[model samples]
Target chain A: MPTTLRDEAAIAGIGQTPYSKNSGVSELALACQAVRGAIADAGIEPREVDGLVTFLMDSSDEVEVARSVGLGDLSLLSRVAYGGGAAVPIVQQAAMAVATGVCRHVVVYRALNGRSGQRMGQGVSGDIITSDLIHWSWYMPFGMLTPASWVAMAATRYMHEYGDCADALAQVAVVTRNHAQNNPAAAFYGKPLSLEEYYNSRWICEPLRLFDCCQETDGGCALLITSPERARDLQQRPAVIRGVSQASFDGQEQMTSFYRPDMHRLPEMERAGETAYAQSGLGPADMDAAILYDAFTPEVLMQLEAFGFCGPGEGADFVRDGALAAGGRLPTNTHGGLLSEAYIHGVNGVAEAVRLIRGVSHNQPERCEHVLVSSGVGVPTGALILGRDNG
Target chain B: MLTPEQKQDLETQIRAFVGRPTGPPSVGRDLVNEPMIRQWCDAIGDANPVYLDPEAAARSVHGGIVAPPMMLQAWILEGWSMHRGHGEPRDEQQRLHKILTDAGYTGVLGTDTEQTFTRYLRPGDQVSAETVIADISEEKATGVGVGYFITTRTTFCDAKGIELGTMNFRVLKFIPKEAPQSAAANADAADAQPQKPTRIKPPLSHDNAWWWRAVAEGTLLPLQRCAQCQKLRHPPRPMCDDCGATQWDHIAASGRGALHSYTVIHHPRFPGYEFPILAALVDLPEGCRIVSNVVDCEPGALRIGMALQAFIHEDEDGFKLPLFRPAEPA
Candidate 1:
């Protein structure tokens, strides 16, 4: 609320397990492994971790993960929902806890056997996520089953309003895949996607080809958040939390907010960006890079518009000419995003945002100032702004 | 668990009935008429003029008022007799189900359906349906229980024996697990048997069950209107976001709307549905939008602001839902 969390807390460390199709372990195990890695990376003992936060969709309970990873008594245990939309909100929760003296070190994490286990792309037929069931039922019966299909409804309308966007959508996928080529941790590190291949790829849902959908990956990601004072004494250069915001706007549904007056753009994500920018006293011009979610290629275009990187319906032009690549304007998803990187929901994207701020990303831009990071669109989403620790 | 030998024997017995008819063809209790069509249109919130106005119907491709193709099965469904069990099971399909029931698989779940409409029916058409056992599967383990998938094919025809449509329905007969032993169940579970997917039933909550029940009654499409601000809201929420009024009442929709947005789904196919589904969001006259399937039109025909009408379709499992189609030209 009034820059309360702005620069109050910092991401002291980031950790992740290898991105894979199958982790060959339970989600709880994957979560604990990432948590331990984050603690060790922060140069702190497990006993120093007094707060734990994760997505409500996470299979690991806070107590179980803390107990497994040998963490001390937890003062804050929080969970956020709406799938990947909780990516930044989990950080916000940790920042709030640290700012309020509720805890010293808060670990925000996300871990899932998304591919080997419950594939998110397979739709919500048997998934008993109660919050999604009511809204999902309205579409699931008619075969609007998967997340791709849900987003395609908006993509189709976007295309209807703004001629053909195949070229623009291809730019998002191709640019991220190009960035992935430099990062060994990315799922598509060696497999560079060409514009030709993207055009040739089969349709997952019309207007969303196979290359457009994010990988259903199995992995874990975690970040350590603490006060700026403690972060300065840590082992790594901290990525200060300049601003973080999460918002659920009016006429919001899980992924099927078709009832909105305008279904093409994501109002929720726009609200998130406005609040985050206001908190940090920054605008689109201040952001040197970004880590926008690429769960589907069309959402990347919509998010570019939502965050005011470009005018409405002008995202197609904004993403052309390697604009999202390492050397171009607004170098985005430098670690390949969810599209080319492992889909650890969108937590991995947050880690990439921090890497840009720390000037350590493999595809780091020449000038890394304020970096904008977004979670899933088409839902109640969130945004974050991180900056280099000038202190 | 049955031995492989015993399982083969059961499969052989079930396979014998595949070609046999379920029973004598069942006829509709009444001829196709406008009143039934109007009731279906209102119940589902469809306002297609062709189904209601004679002038519009006469000028349209139908050349006369025609019933929604989705209502094909509704015409021949035995009303009170089937529900009350007064109509005894005396068919080959019934005997096959009895055999399965004699075994441990007593629980039944309707999985999916595939319907093909040959043509639309006009008023005065007497519809009849004849069903046959189409196929039966081997015992397989599913998320719910170990079961067998049974498929039945039904052909609907007019009084003159002209083919109207065909529906292939699938259901799973399984042994209901007394308790959920997810760990043990997880170890041997084959992909959760959406091998034949059913329409995921809507969760009936305290605030929205009344709306669903009204749709189930097959009469009106009720919208929740806030008594305080006189605002209408869909999805039946408890409090009005506009006025924060918990006090609300219902108003029947005129079944008219316009297509606001849509998608043609092609991949990650699910069971119990046809491919290239035309899923749409319809902007109703009441200022609320509804998510439903756009029927009776091709993907290329869909536009952002095309007029639409809603209809109520009751599947074989008696799950009533609202679907939309292109409105007849005014």
Candidate 2:
């Protein structure tokens, strides 16, 4: 298959606010701060940005963010939905816009007061009535209300099918927290978690302990995308967007995709990963590191299988062999991921991918050339292949 | 901790009650009927047509209206009067409560419940239930207080004595820690004020109102059948995706299914719910799936592809909901 958008656009800059339980500011302010930081990092004027993309769930609008950041007229403005699943696709949208000349300079950002404000873990409130809630009613009556519970259904099935146990999921928390110990920005920076502690932690949902859930964090993250030709003239080495793709399969529901044929496998991620690899002409072997989404620890394992980092039902074995640690075959979520780092959706993972490609990550891998960044699992998801611009 | 003699005495006392009938088998005051079904449907906001629409019911696979399976317990609750200990303590439950109360464990709170249904109860069916003491746990420390978890198993049947369903309900009987007078007064004052309602019911909408109605009418596992292509879909929709047909009807699903996936929820406790609640995604024989609470089995015992049958679980507020349980071996 021919590569469609390979190396056509590059992530010229990455920026983020210090993630925390409470940012103590408006989401609009957070969006502006991250966008301004991205513009500054890319050595580009705010007025030069001609495109913007964000999640539909984000409070800040494109026009509002543009006004706040002093950007001029925009040529492309788009929003992706499905929560964290929108992370990589917004970048893919920006890269596509830039590559096709729909926009010259594009900025993708996500900002929310997820912790102090609306906690996603609180589940759905009654005031909002939508088609989605109508679908959720089928399960809500049974007390399967939260995202953790929603994903737990699949995670439990995965364990039952593979003969795996909670130990497999606990390893993810241990590994990510270990990485967080060295990163000051991580919420768990000072608190290292042990396997014993993981076992002792109370269950948020069975097969998923408290440690398996991501932090409810308040923060923002943004990325600057531009043509590869324009990136070479910028201040930093660009992480070329070698490939990007978004995908979803038939019978897909938001999180309660219980009707699908296979409960253990995330077909959407597999489709997105396959498309990204085909577009980049770089398979999993080419990736020196990965920044898989860790909204929940089990998702990271599932993504490992979906993205072909390991064979199907081999995720626990892969993690058990230390393949996700610093010196392992594929060091993942070196910044501790959402499990230990603050949850800024998966955009923070994207910033980490850029840092890896730029060779500036705090937990810098020995050889950082290509990094695979995945969006949300158990939803219509996306993936990105970012590579260092060696030339 | 109890002395060895006290432990033995307590064990013998608790063990003697095991396998004894908690109460004489009693029938509901009213046989299953449409008016009660309508009220239930309205209360729970289920709008499935097979429960409410005679025309729709005739065309569906069930061929007639059926009661929501979860109402098995509600049909034979013995009402609030019996529950408040208004009369003589004739039942084993009252005897057990008296035993616990005399021992200084006065407080009571329900801990968990599990139910399994053998078949749907239809209108005009006379329902009855028999209760028995299943287990009595030794004293355990809990966030509320030191308590014993008493589990009761109730078996429901029809007028012909054919088993319809079974429910296992557990409650924590505890001794409250002494409270300071001022704190107790404040708590009383707080309780005196009308508490803000914490229980959130499912948001009812136009497209799925029929589904809730069917649930109210006592139909188990109702799914929309596309009029054009005959495809069965759940989480009901306005139009059929397969044929793009706007016109559709519903079918009362076979309560039989398998545990496709499941989770045990333990955090951010919601009102009107028990902790460590087993939530499951059951794959119906019709090739669709529905999410419901899996009861009557240990959380550890839940496995993929385990056969399950539907049950109607009624909450403390008397709201009925569809649930599931592991199927008994043939």
Candidate 3:
């Protein structure tokens, strides 16, 4: 019924600076690095650009990035909320531009010292003072201030439904580490992991070990989107955008939704996936590789079910069968991941999916064309399909 | 003044406010009290007659001087006043906390809250509180030592006990076998070093720096009042950073506050810096936003949201800083 966002456009180029702790670079500088790098990769002059997409959290301004990258007048530009979800949509937005002829080139970038810069786990310092925090204010007064603790609430419920969520959850961390070990660009690259190590990791919140959570890394990542014809003339191979969609669900409250009727079910993700799968005209059977957002391991299992990769409650069994491994039915987060790779938000996963479709990943699989990239789990999220230009 | 034991208990209870607890029967407030609502209004710099003039009340729609949804409610439990620690000073304060804990409320806690302003606040009205608790959870706490805590969602209402809104709060009552660590030793390691300070040019204020400087230190940056969020929030958010609720009212801070949380860093998240200085989250007397690392104080000595008056600390750069020190209690 609906056309995929993919057949509509392609990712002409991609770029990034090395992920790290102390980048010593201003948020502005890192943004420019990625923007220029993407432009050069796309083989398009900066001045030809007309659109931009980035995180609501990113500090860089559109005009500033345009100036830094030497881009000319812009006709289309926008910002996406709910961090990391913007990665693929940046390309989607660019493709839309070319489809409508409102803009020729679109670039999206995210640069931040997520760890060394603004520490999220630093506790509820600012939010608490407000009346808005009054809800969290109740919890804060008792000490439940961090995101990990809240997510753990959901994880606890999942574990209740399935006796062995820990093992399945750990699989995500292990596999991501497995990929990170092979990929030098990842923050945890060369580092390895074990199920024992995962379960034994320090506890941030109950039901969530330290390794179960996503790490904060300082880095910037960017991508370039344009029409396929224009992409062919660019400096790099183009990864055609196959399909894309974003979704937010009912009962959604920041990351802390403890009172939901059911913590185990992530309806928002299912809603997003339902729209995306139809748009892409591709189902789990068609996807050769996957790059699902893995901010938390439990999320991986929940996403598997939401995407219909497995039926409800069958996710653990599905993952246990090696369905989501490098040699398994669907290789996922092969670029490591936010869990193992440095978290450049969910955008890094987008880059990896593009690489998979382009057949250039460090953990490249055989004959991979249809790649799936997703945003964060639990929060408002999005996804996209990137395929080799089969046409 | 109360006895040493009462003082200690008061401090412990206060420390539990904010950040979820790992263990049991801990006490936190259920609703906004007249005093707390008053302070929040003043700190936020809302000068509306609804919060200041009681005589102007009785004529309004919601009837009495109903607090803005964002006002802080001083939580107390019933029957908790009988706790032996009351042998200490600050009798009224301890009594209130004790009542909150001992009332028929078992692990009754605050849950989620949403605020939309129909009218500004005014001082005094037939103020009373109604509370309801739900969503009970049994879990181990994070940070400090391990123990089980029960978290509940709370809704607060007006005098007729009519529901105004809700807040979810958590309480971890120690299950019989579980004993939480009573006193936590301050983090032992010496703070490593502060990062090389970013040479932000002097007078970083887009507004009046002089007024803010009157409150605190050099290089602390001027405490610019946000025209949005109707309170003295800092790190100067363009929108109400917490809820993204954008109705803003910028008022200069009264330069008074309390230290909410503090830690001396061993390593600066940035770079450079030779010694570890005190970095604390100051709960300003003005409502909204507890700022970070208002430097000065031996690392461990900073208590949770210590009463602080504003001061100006000088940094290596010529610019002034906004810092807070233990202020005379309001």
Clashes per candidate (backbone, < 3 Å): 2, 18, 88
Write the residue-wise lDDT of candidate 3 on A1-391 in tens digits.
Answer: 2233547678887888888888888888888998898888877788888888888879999899898889998988788775655655555666677777777788878888888788665445342233334434433322345656556556655765766567777777887789898889988877799888887787565466788888888888888888877787776777887777777786565665443446688887788777777877788788898888888788888888888788988888888887777888888889898888878888778878878877899989997978878887767777787788865
Candidates arranged by TM-score, highest first: 1, 2, 3
Total residue pair clashes for candidate 3: 88
lDDT by residue (tens digit), candidate 1, A191-297? 99988999999988888899999999999999999998899999988999988999998878888777776777889999999999998889999999999988999
Docking quality tier of model 3: incorrect
Q: Give the per-residue lDDT of model 2 (tens digit) for A1-391.
A: 2238899899998889988888999999999999999999999999999999999999999999999899999999899999999999999999889888899999999999999998988886565789888877777777878999998888988887787756778888899999899889898999999888889988998878899999899999999999888999999899999899999998888987887778899999999999999998899999999999998889988989999999999999999898999889999999999899878889999998998998888789999889999998888999999998965
CAPRI accuracy category, model 1: acceptable
Off by over 4 Å in 1: A1-3, A126-132, B1-197
What is candidate 1's CA lDDT for residue B125?
96
Which 10-residue window in model 2 chain B sums to the lowest lDDT? B188-197
Candidate 1 local lDDT, residue A370 = 89
Q: DockQ each candidate and list the results.
A: 0.38, 0.48, 0.02
- Superposed by TM-score, candidate 1 places the C-alpha of residue B218 at a distance from the truth, in angstroms, of 3.1
